[model samples]
Target: MIRALLDPSEGEPVQIERAGGRSPVILVCEHASRTIPASLSNLGVKPDTLTSHAAWDIGALATAQKISQLLDAPLVHQRFSRLVYDCNRPPEAPDAIPEMSEIHAIPGNRNLSGEARQQRVAEIYEPFRQALAALVAARTGPSRQPVIVTIHSYTRVYFGAARHRAIGLLHDRDRRLADTMLQQAEEHGITNAMRNYPYGPDDGVTHTLRLHAVQNGLLNVMIEYCSDLIDTEKGQDEWAALTTRLLEAALERFDIHAAGSQQA
Candidate 1:
């Protein structure tokens, strides 16, 4: 028998907070945890690499949770490391189980068999995908329309090159929410915001947005916070407040009700 990716004691792969939240906004943090399944033995990575951006999006979960609290929105996050499955990516994507993330090479992923890859997909990605899908579906009727907002954080420097942007509002073909957020950032005194600076759809970074939001014709946007900016509780709270304001502004711009119903 193939060694299982997740043990019986490992708990569920997807974590949903405020599942019954009244807000129509559904927040997602795909790279929330740096936890590798004990079966994977840390994927043979170094101690520091195990906690680095390659393993998870630093500060993203805390920021997302804060946004969820501020908006009374529901949050769905993955419990396993992105190096294990990359919940944002589809099963066929090349980097879904990356062999290398930036300068750190993933030793266990180097020679993964078909079964190993499939195991990660079945054990890690599927649960996260299904939970998020179910949440969206539940909010997708005439009475309520859900918004998809995925949160993430990026490193100050990657491969020795520094990233200057403090925040990023990314979107795919549908730029409705992202555009409005960017426009409102300056008004909120957040002048360092940029459009698709750190990563874009071309980089396959918008998988969650494309799959859950664009395909469903729902309003959506991906928010990227610089790691250094949201690395503390104060920073998380500050960014969360900013995100809540921007989301409210965008919803109002679209005439979406706070109760999640369309004005019509």
Candidate 2:
């Protein structure tokens, strides 16, 4: 039998926030936590690396929580570090359990028995998928479908170069929501908003969008903020407010109402 990677006492693999919210938006922060199961021993990475962006998307969960509150939306997030098993990545992807993140070699992930890998998938990835899927299903209907929005953060400097983009709106083949937000962001005085900047769908970053939104025929978009912009409570609040406004405007532009509101 495969040993479980996560201790049940530690915590569940997924965390849901505002599950009873009335909004039609379902927010996701796949890299919300940087927690590693004690069994992994920090994946043999340095202490500092555990806190870095490689482990989780810095400031994303806080900003996502604020946005979920502001919009009264439901949020589903992962509770373990992406280094354990990236919830956003497909299981077959090499980086799903990366051996090397940026310049840091993850010694623990270098050689893994198939059973060990499956344990991470069973303990972490599967739970997140189920929770998110259930949340989406609960909100979707023939006349109304929830909009899926994912929050993430990127480092200011990568590979010795400064990233000047303040925000990025990423999308896969479906750009319905992202296009509207990109245009509205610029009009809202966020001139630095770029489409597919920092990371694009081609970078294998849109698995969640493809798996949940696209397959379900629901509108979706992924928002990326620079780490420095939302690393503080003040910054997280500011961005959450700004993002809420943009999302509201986008929904209005599309003439979309919150799912089940008509019946409510």
Candidate 3:
């Protein structure tokens, strides 16, 4: 029998915020939590390392939460550390259970048995993806499709180099939504917003977009905020308010509307 990676008392692996929201936009935060199950023993890494960006996107969840509230959009976020199983990555990707993230090596992920990998996927990844799919399907239809937006954050300094971009708008083959958001950011005096800065679709960070948005022929985009900029509640609020405005403007500018009847 395969041992369960997540215990019943550990709480649900997926955190759905505003599940019944009526907005046409669906928000996803794959690296929202840094909680490692007690069974993994912090994945053999130092306790402090679990608090770092390698474990989770520091301010991405808070910012995402603010955006969800501002837009009244349903948000689906993972409750486990990305180090356990990166929901945004395809299972075949080595980094899904990374042995090394930046300069920090993860001892637990090293030389894992096939069953170990499968357990994580079964417990953490599939449920989140399914929930997101169901959420999107319920809101989308033949006449219209809901927009998919993922929120993420990048470190200001990576591999000893400083990154100056404050915001990054990433996309794959389809740039429809990203292009419009970038234009709006620039017009709103937010010049730090760049297309595919820090990381892009080519970096294998677009799995969620590829699986849900691109494959399903829906408009989608990923926004990356500099972790330092939105690290605090005040900062999250400011960025969220700004992002909400830009998002609303983009939707109106593109004449996009909720596909089905709006739900509370």
Quick one: best lDDT, which candidate? Answer: 1
Tens digits of per-residue lDDT, candidate 1, 1-264, equal 598778889999999998988788899999999999998889899998987899999999999998888777889999989998899899999999999999888999998888888998999999999999999998889867899999999999998999999999999999999998898888876889999879999999999999899999999999999999999999999888887877887788988744322222
Candidate 3 TM-score, true structure as reference = 0.95
> Per the 3 Å backbone cut-off, how many clashing residue pairs does candidate 1 have?
0
Among all windows of 10 consecutive residues in model 1, the one with the lowest summed lDDT is 255-264
List where candidate 1 sits over 4 angstroms from the true fold. Answer: 258-264
Instruction: Give one digit per residue, the lDDT tens place, for model 2 in 139-199.
Output: 7888768999999999998878999999999999999999988878877767899999899
- The per-model lDDT (C-alpha) reads 0.90, 0.89, 0.88
Which residue pairs collide in model 1, if any?
Answer: none
- Compared with the true structure, the alpha-carbon lDDT of candidate 2 equals 0.89
* Candidate 2 runs further than 4 Å off: 258-264
lDDT (C-alpha) at residue 256 in model 2: 75
Candidates in descending lDDT order: 1, 2, 3
Mind giving the per-residue lDDT tens digits that candidate 3 earns over 116-139?
999888889999989999988888
Structure candidate 2, residue pairs in collision: none
